[model samples]
Target: MADFDVKPSVIDRVRDRPRRLQRLAVLIVILGMGLALLYPLLRDRHGAPIEVRDVPRLPPENLAVIPLAASPTDDPRRVALGRRLFFDARLSPLGRSCGNCHVPASYGTLRAARSPGLGDQLDEFNVPTVLNAALSPYLGWKGKITSLADQLHRVINNPRHMGSNWAWVIETLSADSDYRSRFSALYADGITRSSITDAILAFERSLVTPGAPFDRYLRGEFGALTSEQIAGYELFKDYGCIACHQGRNLGGNLIIRFGILEDPFKDGFFDAATPKSKRFLKLRVPSLRNVAKTGPYLHDGSVETLEEVVRLMARYQLGREMPEEDVRRIVAFLHSLTAPLPENFR
Candidate 1:
C-alpha cells in the first residue's frame, strides 16, 4: 500500500457514485414502505382536518343528524366490514368487545355510569356514545383527543377500555382468515393496526341515528315536538345551556369546564378515593343525543336519573340550583335530542 497514495482516483470515485445513489434509493424505498405500514398506528395523532369550532357552520340543528351517513367515502363495502369489526370481541386481549361498554341497544353507551373494564376495575371516565362521536371536537371525558381516528389507539390500549395494544392485536387479527380477508378486501395492507382502527371508525361514523322527532322538528315539522318539549327547548336556550351544548350532536362539539361556578365533583358525586385534582374542569360536554337512554350521566356516571342531571347542571354549570319544575321542563327538552337508529342499523 502506498503511504500517501490512499486517495481514490477521479475515475474510481465516479464509478462508485452510482452504487452510492442506488443504495440511497433503496433505503428511501424501504423507509417509505415502513411509513406507509406504520401510518395507521400513528395516524391518531394527526388531530382533525377541522377543529371542532371550525366545523363549517353546521346545518340547521335538525338537518345536522342526517340518516346514517354512508361512510366518509360512501363505500358500503368498507362500512359493512367495519360494522363486523366494531362488534368483534377478538379485538381485545381479554376478549371483551367494544360493544361491551357501548351496546347498541342502549344507544352506543352502556347503562353503567362508569363502564366496567377488564377485571374488576371500572373506567375512570364515562364511556361516551359512539353515535355522532365523529362530530365531537375531542374525545374522552376530559376532551383530550381530537378526532375519532386518533381515539382508536387510546381505546385499544387503555387498560380500562379495549385493554390491548398493536403487538397482540395485530397478531391475533392477522391470524384470522375471515378477518384477514375482510381487511384485504378493504385495505391493500390488510389487517394492520391502522386498517383495523379505520374500519371501526367507518362503522362508528355510520352509527348516527337520524329521524328522531326532534330532528323532524328542526326540519320544519313543527308538530314533531310536543308543547312541553317545545317549551323545554325555549328554556334550554334561555338558560344558556345551549351555549356549550348546541351543535350537530348538541354538546359534543364544545368543551365546557364541568364546574364554572361550583364544583359538582367537590360534592359527594365522586368517591373520596378519587383524586381531587381530577375532580372538575375542561370536560368535553357530552352530546344530549339519546341521552335519556344513556344513563347514568356525567363523565363518572355519577348521576342516575336524567332529572337529577338537569338539576345538577343548573347548580354547577349555571351556578343556580333550578327548581324541580324548571328542571322538569329542561329534562323534557333534552328528551327531544334522542333519535332512533335508522332501520338498517337497527
Candidate 2:
C-alpha cells in the first residue's frame, strides 16, 4: 500500500495539543496577533468578560452579568464645553436645553412619566436616564440610534424635541463671545454641527456613575449586598431575567420583544390612549443601573413601581407566577445597582 499522507492545519494541530498547552499557545497567539481571535472566546456577545460561578443547576461558564465601569475619559476641555452646551437653552428656539429633560438630580432623566418637548408636545416614550448611558450600545426605547451624536442630532432636529436646526444653532452660538472663544480653543472647524455634537457627546459620555453595591459585590466584596439582595440576584438569574438584561449596563445592550411568553400590553398594564401605543411591542430594554429612582417604569412609563414591574416581567416575559416576597427581594437586588451621584452632577 502506498504510504498514507495526512497533514493537519494549524488550528487542528493546536486543538490536538494538550489542553493546558493549547491555552498557552492561544495566549501566545492572542498576544502576538491582536485580541480579535481570543476576544470572542473570553468575552460575551457584549464584549464583557464571561464569568463562571458555582450557582444552582445553571451552567457555571454561562454567567451573563458583568459589573459596570466608567467610560473612557474625553478631553477635559471638550467635556466642559459639552457640559456648558448641555445646560444652555440657547441651543433651542424654545430655550429648552438637554438638561431641562435630563435633570441631573433625577438620575439624568425627568420625574414625570413623559417629558414635554419644544411646544406642548409630550414625548411618546419615557426618558431613559443618561447616567452610565455610555455603557449602552444603543439609545432610545427602539434602539434605533447607535451613537450619542446621532441621538443628539435627532433630538435637536425633531419638532417634538428641540425643534431647531444647525443653521439656527450655529448662528445663535456664534453670536456669543464666550462660545466663540471656547469653540476656537477646542475645535479647528469651530462651531459647526459636528463640533457641537462632539462636544455634547463628550459631556454625555462623561456621565458615568460607578460604585454601585452590586458592582462592589462583583468585585469580591462579599458583604456589600444584604442577604435578601443576594437571594434576589439568584432569583433574577434563575428566573431568566438575566437573558435580556445582561452585560455591564444590564439591559440597554439588548432589544427584545416586550413579551416573550405573553402579551404585556394586554394585561391591562398598558394604556391604549397613549400616543403610538401600537409601535412599542418590540423595544430596547432600559438599563437597570438606577432602577430604584428612574420611574415610572416601562417604555410608556405605565408601570409605576419596581415591584409591580418585576411581577409583570415574571408573568409576561418568563411566564412564571412570582410570589410577592420574591418580587420584593428582586427589587431589593435592583436597588443595589444604583450608584452614587456623579461628581458635579448638578
Candidate 3:
C-alpha cells in the first residue's frame, strides 16, 4: 500500500480548532436562547411561580392554566364600599346600576339573552358574570377595554349602558353623604371620577373566587374532582377546548372569531350584510368560572344549556361534532369549575 498519513498536520489541527470552537459556541447560544424563551412560559402571568395553597403545580407554561389564588391583600373596607356602589341604582341616569345586569346571585350576570340598556335599546351581547373577572386580561364581549377602570368609565358613559357622563356620576355620587364620607376616608381627592373608578376597581379586583374544585385539583388536591369530571377535563384538553380557554380565568384572555371552523352566525342573526368588523362576529372568549350558573350562554346568549354550548363550541370552534358521552363528560368538568361567590360579592 502507498504510504499515507491518516493524521492531520499540526497546522491543519490548529486551523480546525477555531471551527470546532465556533460550533460549540453556536450550540451554547442556541441552548441559551431556548431556555430564555421557555423561562417566561414556565412562570405565571405575573412572573411568579404558579402556586395555590402553597403548592406549586403545573405552571401556565406547562398546562396552559394556572391555579386561582386568593387575593388576601384586598382591603375589606374598599371592597365593602365598592360593593355598596355596585348595587346602587343611582350610578345610571336611567336608575339602572351595574348590579341591575351583573346580578351577584346569578354569578354576576343576568338570565336575559340580552340586557335592556339605558333606553329602549337592548345590549347586543350577553352579560358575562363578574365573578373571577379580575383574572381576565380583557373585559366585555368585544374585548375593547383593557382596564377595569376604563370598562367602568365606558359603561357609565356609553349611551346604551349607563347613559350618563362623568359629570352626572360625580354629581349623583357627591350628593350622597355616605359615599362622600367613604371617598374622603379612602381618597384625598374625594368625589372625583378617578376616585369613584378607583374604589369600584378596588372592589372588582377583590372579586376573586379561588376555591373551585378544579382550582383545588390544580393546588395538589388530586381527589377534589370526581372521576367523571377528571375524565371530562382530559377530554376537554383532547378536544382542543383548552386552546383558547386556558389560564386562571379560562377563556377570558383570548379574543377569537366567533366561528373559526364554521360560521355559528350564518343563517342566523349575522348575515353577509353584517360587516366583518362587527362585534357580532368577533368577540372575547368569556371565563368559564361559575359558567354553569351564568347561563343563558354564548356572546349572544343564544344557547341556553351548558350541554348545548359545549356541542356548539365543538362544532363551530373545533370543526367537529363531539359524541354525547364526551359532551356529558366535558360538561361535568365545567361543573368542577364553579366556585362560590366571593364573600363580599353582595
Candidate 4:
C-alpha cells in the first residue's frame, strides 16, 4: 500500500468521536426526561394543557344563570363552618363521610351506581351530586324537598342513607372539639340539629362546578368546544333536551316524567317488585353540569355510561331511538358541560 498522511482534521474528528457520542447521549437523556415530565400532563382529562392566555375576555350574550335553589347563607363564618362539617365522616354511623357518596373528584358523586350506606343498607336510588344543588328547586327524585337544609335533614334521618339520626349526629359533633369550635364560630347556640344540618347544607350549596367548556361556549367563547361537541349541542337543542335541560345548571330547574313515551318503571326503575302506578309521575330532572363524571345515570343509576343514558333518554323521554352517531355527538356535548369545581372544594 502507498504511504499516505491522513489529514489532521480527519484525525481530530476521529479522536473526538467519544465527545460527540457524549453530547448525543446527553441530548437523548434530556429529551427522555422532558417526555417523562410531560406524560402526566398528557393524561389530563382535557387532553391538552389548559391555555388560560387564550381564554375569551368577554362573556357571551344571552348567557344567563337560572337560579333553581336559593344559595345557602352567604355568611363567610357559616359557609366556612359548613365546609368543614361536610367532609366530617365521623357524623355518619359508618366511617363514610358526605364525600363518600358524593365524591368531589367525581363532581360530588361517587363512582357507584347506588351507594352502600350504614352497613348492609345501600342507597336504593343513585346518589346525586351535591354540585349545583343550589340551582335546583327540589331535592331528590320525587322533588319534594324544598331546601338544602331539608335535603340534609332527610339524608341524615334516612337509615338507609346517612344511617345516622339527628340526636347521634348532634351529640357526636358536639363531642368533637374541632367541630365544637367550628360550630361556635358560626352558630350562637352551638351544634344543634339545625346547626349541624345547616352547616352541611351551606357547604353543599357551594359545591357548584363552573368553567366547563359549554359554559365558556355559552359565554361567547365559541372556540371552547370542539366541532363534535358543538354538533352535540345542536342535537341536544334540536332533540328537545333543552326543554328540560336548559338554563345554566341545565335540567336542575325542572321536574319531568322519566318515561314520557314508555314507562321505564316496566324495567324496574323503582323496585320492579312493587306494583306499577302511573308512569307519568315527575322526577326532579338532575343537572347535566357534571353528568359526564356523575355517572351511572338517572335516578336509579341503572345505566352505567353516558352513551347508554342518552339512548335511554331518547327512547323513554323522546319516544324515539337516537342514531348511534347522534348519541356519540350528544355524549361529547354532555362532556363539554363538565367543569372543575373552584379551588379548596375537594
On TM-score, the candidate that comes out on top is 2
Ranking by lDDT: 2, 3, 1, 4
Rate residue 260 of model 1 by lDDT.
88
Candidate 2: tens digits of C-alpha lDDT, residues 1-346: 2333334455577678789987888899878777777676766755442333334444322247777677678998999999999999999898888888888888888888887854677777888888878767778998988988788889899887788888999999999999999998999989999999899988888888779999999989979999999999999989989988887778787778888888765656577554555634778888888889899888777778999899989988899999999999999999999888877577
Model 1 misplacement above 4 A? 1-73, 343-345
Question: Residue 103 in candidate 1 has what lDDT?
Answer: 82
Better of 1 and 2 by lDDT: 2
Q: Between which residue pairs do clashes occur in model 1? A: 44-150
Measured with C-alpha atoms, the lDDT of residue 103 in candidate 4 is: 77
lDDT by residue for model 3 (1-346), tens: 2334534565577677868788898999999999899887766654554345334543453248778888656567777888888888888788888988889888899989987864677777788888777777788887877888888988888888777899988898899998889889988998998877877887888888889999999889999999999999999989999988988788788788888888765746444565655734667888888898899988777788999999988988999989999999999999999988888875
Across 230-264, the per-residue lDDT of candidate 4 in tens digits comes to 99988998898877776667866667777898887
**Candidate 1 C-alpha lDDT tens digits along 3-104:** 446556755776778677878989999999999998987775555544654655654543233322223554777777777777778888788888777788
Q: Give the candidates in order of TM-score, highest first.
A: 2, 3, 1, 4
Task: Give the worst 10-residue stretch by lDDT in candidate 4.
Answer: 58-67
Provide the overall lDDT of each model, using Cα atoms, as 2-decimal numbers.
0.77, 0.84, 0.83, 0.76
Top candidate when judged by lDDT against the true structure: 2
Q: Count the backbone clashes (under 3 Å) in each candidate.
A: 1, 0, 0, 1
> What is candidate 3's CA lDDT for residue 168?
88
Question: What are the clashing pairs of model 3?
Answer: none
Q: What TM-score do all the candidates reach, one by one?
A: 0.77, 0.80, 0.79, 0.74
